[model samples]
Target: MGHDLDVLAARFGRHYPRWLLALLIISTMTMVLSSTSINVALPAIMQDFAIGRPLAQWLVTGVLAAMTSGLLLSSWAQARFGPRATLLTSFGLFLVTSLVAPFVTSIWALIAIRIVQGLCAGIAQPLSMVLIFRTYPGEGRGMALGLFGLGAMMAPALGPTLAGFLVDHFGWRAVFWLPAPVCILSLVGGALLLPTLRSLTPPRLDVPGFILLNLALFGILAALAEAQRFGWLHDATLLTGAVGLLGLAAFLWRCTHHSAPLLPLRLWRNASFRHTSWVSMVLGVSLFGVTYLVPLYVQTVEGYSASDAGLLLLPTGLVLGVAVFAGGWLSDKLAARWLLVGGLGLLTLSTAGQALMGTGASFWAICAWASLGRLGIGGIMPGVSTAAVQDLPAEELAPATGTISFMRQLGGALGINLLTFFIEWRHVAEGASAAGDAQAFVQSFWLLTALFALALWPAWLLRSKR
Candidate 1:
């Protein structure tokens, strides 16, 4: 097999790595598109299903929660089954879920399918990142991830616009149908491009740790979702929140005691990885929070059609694609902390700008502000991703990637839930009129701005001496 691969490598030469990276970018982008595109369609789905905002949000939260738990599985999966088999299995599952999702009548059924899809995506994301990091030379990894980030970030940036159009013309179900073709293409590409890399002695999956982690995530997410309806101090909310916090404490303890832990907590021993992980979580909150907030804001508050809401972010996506590539390239030459600080600064400005947006704001004005924030993200993604695992030893890379990805997804799941409840709480407080709607969204954007600003402290600490 080694000899055959050597011959194949010689035949393909330098192009082989590029082809593999391309396949990874495409497949991962499709996974992201399947999830992010749903944001614009949520209102439509809510109407069709006769659900409220809390339940409607499960469509998005379900994916993030399952995906967060799934991140821990990738290290074990890739080691046990090899990258080719693991990725193919993930792609296959995603393809099946994508095809079946549109036909479901119940929102719960659709949410269930989304959870499966998110799990498949969860398994694929870190694997792809590890493969990309391994494929490039040390000097070139920043550029390689930048290129990857271009596709990954672009999916969320553009996905909403396309989904909006589909929702307006065909219906919300059309959003699910969109990713199927891409999934099929990705399956074919993965079979041809991904290499078979497996550990001889793969770590065992920590069943107790996995269960505890999910319970923690589910309890927290459920508490947030329920908070808007039952009040934050209510017994149901308090109970769920307590369960989540306790589960988290137990999961952390298990990571240290378990022989084969799901996510090795020891990765945090590296100071750089710790700082970078903090920034990654903050980045996730910004990434998913804005995607969720803006679409709903424009449609519900400003009375923009779904298509118009989607269109608002199209320019932002394009900017992110270009900026991500540039940021990646720069990361290889410059200090990552410099880039992170600068990026966070830009994000702070962008979010602060967004807080001032209202119903009277022009379409182009909204796009400009959103695009500014994405440009900042392009800068952050490469620097943080590269810095997180660049210092870790070879054996620890897979778990490190899984851990960082887990943090990001965890932040996103909880961020969306919290933001959902915050908006609901504030909207009612403001009297629930057009004025109230605008104020609620403005306040939400301000909260995001503050989060971004708070992250700057950690971003500055990312390899400061370097």
Candidate 2:
């Protein structure tokens, strides 16, 4: 494979970057598609597994938590294993898990497999970003990452529709099967074209810090997931919350004091990166939060089928793909702070529109609202992502990319559970009528709108340093 790739590279030396981008995008897309495509399949999985929402919720949140932890591992993995080995290994693991998932006999087994899948995804994603950032010139990096973002976002945007169709016709298992072929292709591509960008002296993995971070993330998500069922003051919730907080504090302390920390704590000193990280976390709340909420609302409250719910967001996906490219192009031409603020404003408007929408709101109305939100996301991703690492030195690329991705996924995992808790709490408070369910969803959207509005402060702070 190495010899063949070398020959091919010599023949197409000038076009190497494009080929590399194409390979990375598709690989990353397969990983991201796996993440959100399962959202529509949640109902089916619940029914098949004879599980409640909170337990079934683990299938998603567990993966996000694992994925979030996996992001921090990218820099370490790249240093220890090199990029070629790391990317291929992650892709290979993802492929095996996707293949095995359909056959799991127990819900715990499936969730475990999915978490493994998420770990692989978490490792692969940020490395791809680092590679893209390295491959592109300064002038075109925004557009490059924008195109990369489009591929990543496109999967989540369109994945559910495909997943819904698969679930309706085949079964929930088909969603697991969906990424297998693409993952295989990615594996082959990585083996052939991936450069071995290893550190000169490999960094030792911080096993204790890694364990602490996962403990913190899973503890918090577990607490959030169960808080509505067990009161927030309940022992389980309180215990888990405390575990998460303490673990987080310990991990931060380790990052500050350890000789070779898992994360580069000093990266936070970059004011632009700090602002961008905040904006990214807040954006994840809206991005993944809405994706999880919308499908459940349409299917349960509005009496749509899974496929119907997925179809409603189909237009939004298409619009978002185009908007992301435009946003990337615009980032190169405009101040990133302006794009970030404008994007947040649009997201706030989109969620507010959804909040005010009644259960009887028309399909097109919902589509319009969803598309507006995605447009805002498209605008935000290119600007925020470009700003996060643009000013950092080359050596910080892996950790910087991993940190930004970590913040986003951390927000997403927690955000999804928090949104779920709100729905459950509101449903119980208002009684379980159809009206109550609809109102619960409406209230959740309002919560999202508020979060988006709150993000504008960080977005404003993303000004270019003189």
222-247, model 1: which lDDT tens digit per residue?
88887887888999999999999999
10 residues in a row with least lDDT, candidate 2: 1-10
Model 2 lDDT at residue 16: 79
Q: Could you report the Cα RMSD, in angstroms, for every candidate shown?
A: 2.7, 2.7
lDDT for model 2, please. Answer: 0.84
Per-residue alpha-carbon lDDT of candidate 2 for residues 1-466, written as tens digits (9 for 90 to 100): 4434355467569687788899998999888888888888898888898886677778878878888888888877877877788899988889899999999889999989989988998888888877876667576776677678778888777888888899889998999999899888988877668877667798788899999888888888878876866778999999999998899899999999998787678999988888889888887776677888898889878888888988887898898888888887788788888888889999999989988987789999999998999889878987777788877899987578667877888888888888888888888788987788888898989998888999899878776632
Off by over 4 Å in 1: 1-18, 132-145, 233-235, 269-271, 386-398, 461-463
What is candidate 1's local distance difference test score? Answer: 0.85
Worst 10 residues of 1 by lDDT: 1-10
Using lDDT as the measure, the top candidate is 1
Pairs of residues at least 3 apart in sequence or in different chains that clash in candidate 1: none
